[model samples]
Structure formats: C-alpha cells, structure tokens
Target: MTNRPRIALVTGATQGLGLALVEGLASRLSPADTVYLTGRDAGRVARAVAGLPATSAQVRGELLDVADPDAATRLARLVEERHGGVDIVFGNAVMRIGPDDDPRALMDAYTQVNNFGTTRLMRAFTPLLRDGGRFLVVASSLGTLSHLAPVLHDRFDGLSSLDEVDKQVAAWRDAVLDGSAAASAWPGFINIPSKIAQVAAVRALASQRRDDDLRRGILLAAVCPGMINTPTSALWWDVSTAASPAEAAVPLLDLALDPVDPGHYGQLVRFGRALPWKP
Candidate 1:
C-alpha cells in the first residue's frame, strides 16, 4: 500500500498457484516493487523468473528447499540482507510425489513439505517480514469437518481433535497396507486445510508478538486457491474440472494486496469468501 513499492517473497513459485501468484504480483507492480521467486529447483526458479515480463526491477529467483532447515535459514538470511525487509511472504509449496504406490510414503512427504516445511519457514522468516505486512498460507478446503465424525471432528472431519485425526490417518495407512479401501476414514489431522491453518496461525502469532501494533495492519491468513488444476492434485481435483492456476490466484492476490484488514489476522480465506479454517 505504500508508494515505496512492496517487496514480496513467494515460495513454491515455480509452478501452479505459486507460479501464477508471482505473475499476478509482477503485473501489478509499478516498477518500484520487487518479488523474490523461490523453489527447491535452481533451474526451475531461474526459468520462472526469466519468463515473466514487465516485472519490477525486483523479480528474481532464489533456491529454497523448505523441507530442509538449513536451506530455509540460508534463504531467510539472504532475503533479510538483500531486501532489508520483506513486505509479503507467500507460503505455497506442497509435496505431491507419489508412485510405486506406498500410501504412507505419499502422506509422509505431503505432510513434511506442506505442513512441517511451512511451520519451519514461519519460525525463520517471521523476523524479516515488516510489521503490518501480509503472510498468506495457501492450502485446500479438505481441512473442514466431517458429518460422520464425532463431535470433535475437524472442519474436514465435519467435527475432531488433532489426536483423533492422527489416529484416523494411521488407520488409513493400515488399510492401504492391507489393500482395503474399506478402512475407517482418516482423522482430520491429515486434512490439508487444517494443516495449512495450523501453519498460518504461527505466522499471524509471530507477527503479533513482534509488534503489538500489528493487530490491525498485518493480514496473515490461510487461503485455498480452490481445486486449481495443477499436476500436484494427484488427479483428485482433476485439472479439467477445476479452476486454472491464474484464475485461482486472484483471491490470494486480493488478500495479499488489501492494505487494511476488515477482520483480525489469522483468518483463513478461500475464493474471495472467508470461511472458518478449524484452528
């Protein structure tokens, strides 16, 4: 919102929603702004940066593997040194690799990068974010509660606690190992939305702890781009039936650029609509 032009750091920016977000922000910049596109792959990050046009003198690439604590530390230090401060931080990396068909393995990688990686990044980068800026956590709607679940199920469970949800995940693993899709449903902890919300909570809290005045100025929220047809969907939200990356990027951009918050920080939003993201 400042005329000085904002500087943003977007993770997982090499493709899909992350890729589209950088493009959207780049197009909106007035030459005074800048964006740092980061990904685990050096070549991909470079290619993504090079493909953008009219980007502020600021759009560039940095290699960051969120799953690795050391890499995250390096990127955080580098950004703080280079930019002095970061105006926006977009958490959008997700792990979707699966084959040779190991269900537990797939879930392990997914949880590691999408959940733990985001948490680790928040811990390291919160200091770099200027007070009253933005931190958008990108995730999905699956984090909601389930009707069949108990009263405590999550937004994904329709009702549940983290413990119960974790148990459900273990159950699913058992079923998979036994070649039975008939296993009881997974506890909602494995739900993507809940995990994303958990990570974004840290961002919001970290910002608040840094500056008491940040209550109304900073916007830290979990945003679900909503079934974007990216290859990472594992064919669940098929590319054909969902919004394109560009289309899904719009709401997140709104949350990022909105200078004033109508609500408090740590709100989880989706598709321009604000919904409760099970805390």
Candidate 2:
C-alpha cells in the first residue's frame, strides 16, 4: 500500500474549523502526508503546533495573515519549498467588518483579503495544485442558496454558471464602485452588508479561474459548515445548539476527499448537500 499521505494547507488554522481540519487530517492522513497550519499570530501558530500530538504526520506552523497581500505568496512558497505541492487547500479564512468600522474601508479590505487572497494564492501556486487536487472554500448558506432562492432549486447547479449571477454581481459591484454603498436589491444585496461581499468574492474567483484551467479546482466549493455553535454563530444559530465545529468539518472532508466523488469544481454545498448558486 502507498504510504504517502495527502499534503494539505489550511488558512486560519489557529482555531475553529481550521483547527478541526488539521486535527482530523493529522489523525487520518498517511504517515508521509503533511498539514501546514497557518495563522496571523505567530504565538498562536506555535501553540497550536505544540499542542498537536507528535506522530508520523508532519505538522508545520507558519505565520500567515491571509488579509496581508504578501502572506498569500509567502505561504505558497513555503508550501512549495517544504511539501513540494499542497494537494488540498482548505480556504477557511474570512471576516465580518464591524458596524463601527468605516464601511468603505472595511468593504475594500474584505474584497482585497478574501477575494484577492484566494486569487493570489491559487494563482501563485498553480503548479503546486495537481489536476485533481481539491479546492475547498468555506462559505455560508446565506451566500449560496439565499442569494439564489428567488430563482433556482439546486443552488449547486448555478455555481458553474454566471449568466444569471453576473447581472446581480455586476450591479452590486457597480454600486460599490459608485460610492452608493446603500444600493439595494430584492435579495437585499447590501442589506445584509459584508456577507454579500464574501459571496461576491467566491463568484469572482470562480469566473476568473474557470477558463485558464490553470488548476483543476475539482471541487471548488463554498460550504456552510452549518449552524455550529461557535463564537461566531452564537448570535444567529443559538436555538439550534451549534454542533461542535469539529463535527461540522466532517461534511467538508466528505465533499473534498471522498473517494467516490468524481469532483465538484465550482460548486456550492452545505451540510454535504449541493445547492444552486449562480442566480
């Protein structure tokens, strides 16, 4: 049997879903596979590395603030230099701009960090990702089905298409560019505020990468880890009793590394179920 484990890179690895991903991979991956846990805080990174059990799997801690323009390239280089090529990239980094924060500045930062971060990392290390390598993008249900609830049934179907979604995205992007931060739409585009920006980022990435074939996204997905009772979901999903973040990560792993799944490039899924997203 092959002893090599699948090498992976996970952003925001200091805690939450990222941390869970590392733990899960560490437990299951082959002896030779590596998992690089990246975080903005050097201390947190070190702590996380030290905390994990030392076993056959290789674990490396690195300083990576995905919001930092340079961090994207830096991480890619580190992965390439050390692991040769990362087989799976779990993009688990994202943020919510605060209410007191200046909307314009924060919105720009969101765009630059989330959208641009994904673009830069995926582009810089195209060679590092193999043709069948998986690209798991952690997104929200609000961004996928909620955005398309007005028109589609299977939100997963539209992720691979843009004709319908382009109009909505273009309108919103234009509104933002025009400084009309208040622009509105039926699905309440800006009404929900920063959340919309994250969805836009996912769309922009899918559109841009669909053509070059630079890397076979295989399963470029935006997933809603579900109403896990995490600090972030404490406000909205309280009634549901958020499942352990570690437990929520299982679906993501199922969609990403499932041996039976052919692939789900440019697809949207939540709780292991695919949905429509284009419109």
Top model number, lDDT: 1
- Residue range 1-279, candidate 1, lDDT tens digits: 456667888899998888889988887766778888999999999998888776544688989988785877788888778777778889888776433445544665655577667767766776676756777777665544322344334422321233333344444445544655334543433454335334334433544453443643766666767777766564454468778889989878888887645453555567666666443
Q: Quote each prediction's TM-score.
A: 0.78, 0.76
Mind giving the per-residue lDDT tens digits that candidate 2 earns over 58-170? 78788888768787787788777776676777887666443345544555566555555555555555557655566676766666445544433332233433333334444
lDDT score, residue 18, model 2? Answer: 87
Error of 2 at 153 (Å): 16
lDDT value for model 2: 0.62
lDDT of 1: 0.66
Q: What TM-score does candidate 2 get on C-alpha atoms? A: 0.76
Clashes of each: 18, 9
